[model samples]
Target chain A: MTVEKLYDAAGFKTISKGDGKKEVKAIFCCDMLSIAMSKAPASGCWITVVSNMNTLAVATLTDVSCVVIAGGVAVGEDMKAKAETEGIALFTCEEPAFETALIVHDLMNA
Target chain B: MSEVKLSYTISGDDFTRAGEASGDVKSKLKVLGVAPDIVRKVSIALYEGEINMVIHAHGGTIDVTISEKEITMVLADHGPGIENVELAMQAGYSTASENVRALGFGAGMGLPNMKKYSDDMNIETRIGEGTTVTMKVFLQ
Candidate 1:
């Protein structure tokens, strides 16, 4: 699915519309930057509560298609700006990570 | 022989900028048309090393050399050296404080992941001096 489609379907608040047409091949849920750095799939959607600069760095390194910030974590302005500059789609939802993953999983499989 | 050499000075005080160097290297590797899996491997290993430098070593320097056969990264830091290399290599062993864990790091997977991703890994350290990590990922 495309990032735009997931954003609309998941009801996530869009912070940055980076490459809305980018394809999302899978969904990964993890908060540990170390684990995500090595395990996150390329062109996949990353579901995490990590809303920091390093989160974007790992996302970029893993080539994740988009980052869905779960648990309504506050994202810093600098991080948002970096996401836009890096062309990484950023989204947020009040739901916790598992719930967020369920939403993404349903949409992705449906 | 054409080879690309890159070096960066990592600042220990800045946790937010920890992965900048690794991200830049990942981009460069991609631009060079390196395979995606290979790029990811190199990026992950280097990024783990970068984070370690920030969290434990009070920052450090990373030198990377990209050649046709392999990509080599050497990370050297002046902070307190690891007391036990064998234990540090074990997953789930960490000296990072609670604050570091709150940042979603300090899970003790840093060194293991670096070794897992790199084809060859080596660590050298002194009790009161410093530590240096050298890793290589072969381009097949």
Candidate 2:
């Protein structure tokens, strides 16, 4: 699913533009980078992380479809530049990540 | 190319800042074009180690080496050593305080999760001196 769809599913508001056409393979919900890495599905999945570049770094390494910063969001200039360079879409939302995940589950199921 | 080595200090005091090292490693591996699955394995294993450092060790140091064939990570801390290594390795075995559990960890899954995500892992400890964990994840 596109980042837009993900937000819509979670009933969250977008903070940045995202590639909404990106298809998602799986979803991960956690603030910890390691747990997310361990639990998140393989590439083609969408990851909702609560951390900053650190989370993006993990996403880049894992070849995720994109990263959606759910609740507490922080993305610095360096991280944005890196995400752009890596073709990793980084988006932020107003709602918490867990709630957003519920939306994602609904959307994916539908 | 030869194996590339990286090291970082893990702070046990800050829960919010715990995953910084793992994040850095994941990004570095991504930029280097390591396989995605291999990267995940490293990320998960190292992330678990980072949490362990904060929750149990108070802080520590991590050493990571990436080669064309394998990735190795060694995490060392001067915190109280594991009293029961075998039990700690269980999926539900945890000695983390209640506060840690409220923070979303201390569920006793750290070591088990680490082993599940890593190809190989070894742990060494002194009840008072500290604990050392060695983990490996392969890239095929």
Candidate 3:
């Protein structure tokens, strides 16, 4: 499914404009930047509560479909700016990280 | 002979700046039309190395050299060296602090991941002096 479709179904708030049509290959849930960078699929969506600038960096480096910050984590202004500059889609939701991953997984499987 | 040599210092004090050098190198390689797979390999290896420098060592320097045949990276740090390189090489071993783990790192996969992504990797260290990791990814 496209990122936009997932966003709509998952009820996530978009923080940056990206190609919503980008394919979603999988869902990788991890707060560890190194692990995500190493294991995240090319078109995966990373689910995490660790809302730091490095989150965007890892997402960009791995070429993930988008990043979903869970449980309404406070994203820094610098991180938002960097996400826009890097062209990586970012979103946030009130759900916890695990719940968010499950939602994305169900969406993908649907 | 092919070209491009770049070097950057990683500040141990700033966790946020850890991956900047690897990201820069990845962009440069992409601009040079390096193959996507090679770029990914180089990026992952260098990024893992960069994170290790910040989380373990106080900081370090990463030097990258790209030639027609391969891309090579050398990361050297003067922080507390690894007490046991073999144990550290084991997949799940880690000496990172709780604070580092809370940041979503310290899974003990950094070096192993680097080795997995690069075609070749080597390490040299002295317990008090520091550690230097050398890795190379072939263009072919």
Separate DockQ for every predicted complex: 0.85, 0.25, 0.71
TM-score of chain B of each: 0.98, 0.96, 0.97
lDDT of 3 by residue, A1-110 (tens): 88987557656788886888999988888877778888889999889898887787788789899999998887788888888888888998789988888888888888
- Give one digit per residue, the lDDT tens place, for model 1 in A1-110: 78888667655888888998888899999999999988899999999998898899999999899999999898889998999998989999889999998998888787
Winner on DockQ (2 vs 3): 3
Most lDDT-accurate candidate: 1
Candidate 3 lDDT at B119 equals 98
Global Cα lDDT for candidate 1: 0.91
Stretches of candidate 1 above 4 Å error?
A: none
- For model 1, how does the per-residue alpha-carbon lDDT over B8-117 read when each residue is reduced to its tens digit? 99999588898999999988998999998898899999999999999998899999999999999999999899999999999989998998888899889999999999
> Model 1: which residue pairs collide?
none
Off by over 4 Å in 3: A6-10, A105-110
Q: Model 3, residue A34: displacement in angstroms?
A: 2.4
Interface RMSD of 3: 1.1
- Model 2 chain B lDDT-worst window of ten: B99-108
Model 3: fraction of the reference interface contacts it also forms: 0.61
Candidate 2 reaches a DockQ of 0.25
List per-candidate RMSD values in Å.
Answer: 1.2, 4.8, 1.9
Docking tier of model 1: it is: high
